[model samples]
Target: MTETHEIGMVYLAASDLELADAADDVRGLPVVTQLGHRLGEVEDLIIDPVERRARLLSVVSGGILGLGVTERLVPVEAITRVDDRVHVDRPEPAGDGDGRHRGDPADLAEEGYQPELVDRPPFAEVYERYGVMPFWTAGYVVPYFLRR
Candidate 1:
């Protein structure tokens, strides 16, 4: 039996996660410059309808903060899991490619998600009204989104 989704809820699993912080050292990662740079933060992890698994919605990041904070809407299928770390499958930069990105990051359902749900800001007004962030605690997993 499937669980019913809440009126305004986006769901993801616990296993599919990679946490990076400002203090962490990005040794092998490339620099912030370059157009086709595949680095972005893990802004969101929504369920993938096709793979039925937790996926990385956002990755390292587009650019510096306070401008747009552009996020990559990667599908769950591309996420790779190993011991103590989660990895995202970013496409290699192709020479002489068009200006467009490798894939459509908008491959998520808009129904249950609002920008206020995640820490990635720009919904300051709306999130402020709530007075609480969506997932605050360490084990903030929603059971409805999990399939065992």
Candidate 2:
């Protein structure tokens, strides 16, 4: 089942749904920027239940034993290739002193939070960073890779 957010979009954690094709599953795959900088590994997908496609990649990085880990959401449009690793078209953000990017922490969702509770600001930043049109916009097409 999908939950609709205040933004009027229906999103669900892919972990809660089964994929029609197991081979297309991207969870657990490492994510890299265009320069091959390791960003993190995909922990789950934020999928649009109404569209039946993935919208965002929930990537987890920088933590030991799950402590202090950061989760960032990347719009699917940022994905350039998907094979051994998920390659994004953007470059890594410059780091802050703490080894995390400045402003990056603002993108994080609360742990165990429902997808329907996701806010818009972080998603806006993600789409801007990736230069991808938001799915809600007219003329936005589901990326070919995510169609399956």
Candidate 3:
């Protein structure tokens, strides 16, 4: 049996838990911006145990042999579609083409920085960055794509 450990909101990695359907697993899929920019790959799913659904996607990018990889939590509501790649409706960073807009989660990860995942503060920041409602907030709903 998979063991789940709860923190503040009880977010756990989907890799350590059970997926309702194996085919629905998107752990290895590439995450792309709406403009077709490659952000990263889905490292894991952060699920809310109370809701029994995915709330965030642990996206990993920019690392050599897993040494300097950066992981960022993305709200599942940011996902626009899912096929071979997980497409997100995220805006491109506005800058001098360095792709480093201040406070942007994708840009932050590209800079090889991993955000803290076990806290509500970071979770709130991610949800705000993605312009999505937090799972803990009122009127927040899981995306239809993840409903299965």
Candidate 4:
């Protein structure tokens, strides 16, 4: 039986292996599958206020994004275990047929980093209409938000 109610985010593992002893964790782990893989696993967790738990909303699925991969929504409860590998049961998106949920815009806007979005094209238009000012540096226009 599990003891801790509040999750201990960090854990331990034993090491020391020979050259042939191991492959890359993602490539070798059975926890990774075609429909989804651990690489696409979330690095940072997001807490949904309504749901009230830390969920695996997105994963760092090893393609190439700032946090190392894309942001997707996964359910926190779907986790069966987390150990030598991360495991999950992927979720179906909400009724709109997009991965997005129906909610207050204020909630989502509160959830993400908008300074970058403010500087871009369509995003810029949206933000400007909403009166959001994009980040600027030396008066140059960046395609996306970049830190100064």
- The numbered model that scores best in TM-score is 2
Summarize candidate 1's per-residue lDDT along 1-148 as a digit string, tens digits.
1121322223343223232222121222332212334454554444333434442243334433333344433333333332223343435323311111322234233344334333332322222332322232365443221221
Per-candidate TM-scores read 0.32, 0.70, 0.68, 0.32
Ranking by TM-score: 2, 3, 1, 4
Which lDDT value does model 1 have at 84?
Answer: 28
What is the per-residue lDDT of model 3 for residues 1-148, given as tens digits with 9 covering 90 to 100? Answer: 1222333333344234555545556888999999998888886676755545666776777765445555566777888889999888977333222111134546445753433433233456566777777767788676755764
Q: Compose the digit string of candidate 4's lDDT tens values, residues 79-139.
A: 4445566465433333322122223345335654321111112323322332323322255
For 1-148, candidate 2 gives per-residue lDDT tens digits of 5453533334445236654445556889999999888999987776665555677776778865445766677788888889899998877543321122212233344456433333434455567666789888899887756654
Candidates' C-alpha lDDT: 0.33, 0.65, 0.62, 0.31
Off by over 4 Å in 2: 1-16, 20-24, 93-122
Query: Lowest-scoring 10 consecutive residues by lDDT in candidate 1?
Result: 96-105
Best of the two (1, 3) by TM-score: 3
lDDT of 4 at 117: 12
Worst 10 residues of 4 by lDDT: 8-17
Q: Kindly report which residue stretches of model 1 are placed more than 4 angstroms away from their true locations once superposed.
A: 1-38, 48-56, 83-85, 90-148
lDDT of 1 at 49: 37
Better of 2 and 4 by TM-score: 2
